[model samples]
Target: MKTATKINTRLVVFAKAPQAGKAKTRLIPALGAAGAATLARHMLGRTLDIALSAAVGPVELCMSPTPDDAAWLGIAIDSAVQLSDQGQGDLGQRMACAVQRVTQLEPVLLIGTDCPGLTPALLQQAAEQLGAHDVVMLPASDGGYVLLGLKSPCPEIFSAMPWSTAAVAEISLQRMKALGLRVWVGPMQHDIDEPADLDHLPPELMNL
Candidate 1:
């Protein structure tokens, strides 16, 4: 069989400002709201550094409403590309729309800027895997996904599904199966969504 050629993957990082009270609200009790947001800012910075360093193609920073917000929180974003929210709908709709928008021109990888375990090598691996699969998912320990790469746009994965719950990954997989698309599974990782999630975070990060 002929090996598939590499396609330039656009890496889209979804991130938010690390506001003291607005960020990481779930972890506030254990870490204090300011501490929680500080940690969130740290992780977001690390993730962005990795993405910037490891990116093999275009790096798009899909950020919260305004550049000023990211600026105030010290979240370094690529200013060249204008940022936009995933919209008013749930997470799934935003992801579906993002993939659709990018897949129109090139293969795309949409990732959350919260998975500390993610690195350039892993992002590269996700990009390479997309050659063989229509959808590539890096499962998060919280029963969700950290990274999602798409060779072809598929909206069904994001429509009518529970968002921010343990069912996310399963529902996505089921959607892929139903569509008969070849799905690729990357290494299982974790996203910091709750107080319990702190244990898996980097030690230095845990301190904040």
Candidate 2:
């Protein structure tokens, strides 16, 4: 199927509203529920800032609980950000839904508010990659991916599969290969999902 001609890279940043006990639950063990939520809020803001600064295309924040939810009350999202609800599903299902929805508008670079290493330069690089390749992804040190850029909706890659295990990235690569999709895997980066991952936090986040 012919994909939409790439316009601006439709950047989608996925975030769970940083509510205590709901966001960053794994880190709650070390930082406590409040502290973990504080950290989550910081990370979400930082990710949005980075995404907007990239200026690669229109920035959309696909928030869970929808933008109208009280869970998002007082969270200062930028005016320039277009908001959308992630609706319902597991990680893979929500992601597949987002990809399917946006790829029709333009090629999308879907990222989560996790990787501090996902810089504007890297996002631009991935945007460029999506122009020529079928798929581009920034691998996470944990077995998953930090960013997924696609020129078309390839749900098979995001379908029923392990979401959190280290095998996630490899399995995705295998799935893409089976479908004969071109894939660009960027350098691996750390995701602050566990307490030990806090050690990888950059200086800006060290204060947490």
Which of the numbered candidates is closest to the native, going by highest lDDT? 2
- Runs of candidate 1 with Cα error greater than 4 angstroms are 1-5, 68-74, 78-82
lDDT of 2 by residue, 1-208 (tens): 4432334898999999999999999999999999999999999999999899988899999988988989999899999999999989898899899999998888899999988888988888888777778999899999899999988888898888888899999999999999999888888999999999999889988887
For candidate 1, what is the TM-score? 0.90
Question: Any runs in candidate 2 off by more than 4 Å, and if so which?
Answer: 1-7
For model 1, what is the error of residue 188's alpha carbon versus the real structure, in angstroms, after optimal superposition?
0.7
Cα RMSDs, all models: 2.1, 2.8
Distance from true location, Cα of 137 in model 1, Å: 0.5
The candidate that achieves the highest TM-score relative to the unseen native structure: 2
What tens digits encode model 1's per-residue C-alpha lDDT throughout 155-191? Answer: 8888888778899899889889999998889889988
lDDT of 2 at 78: 91
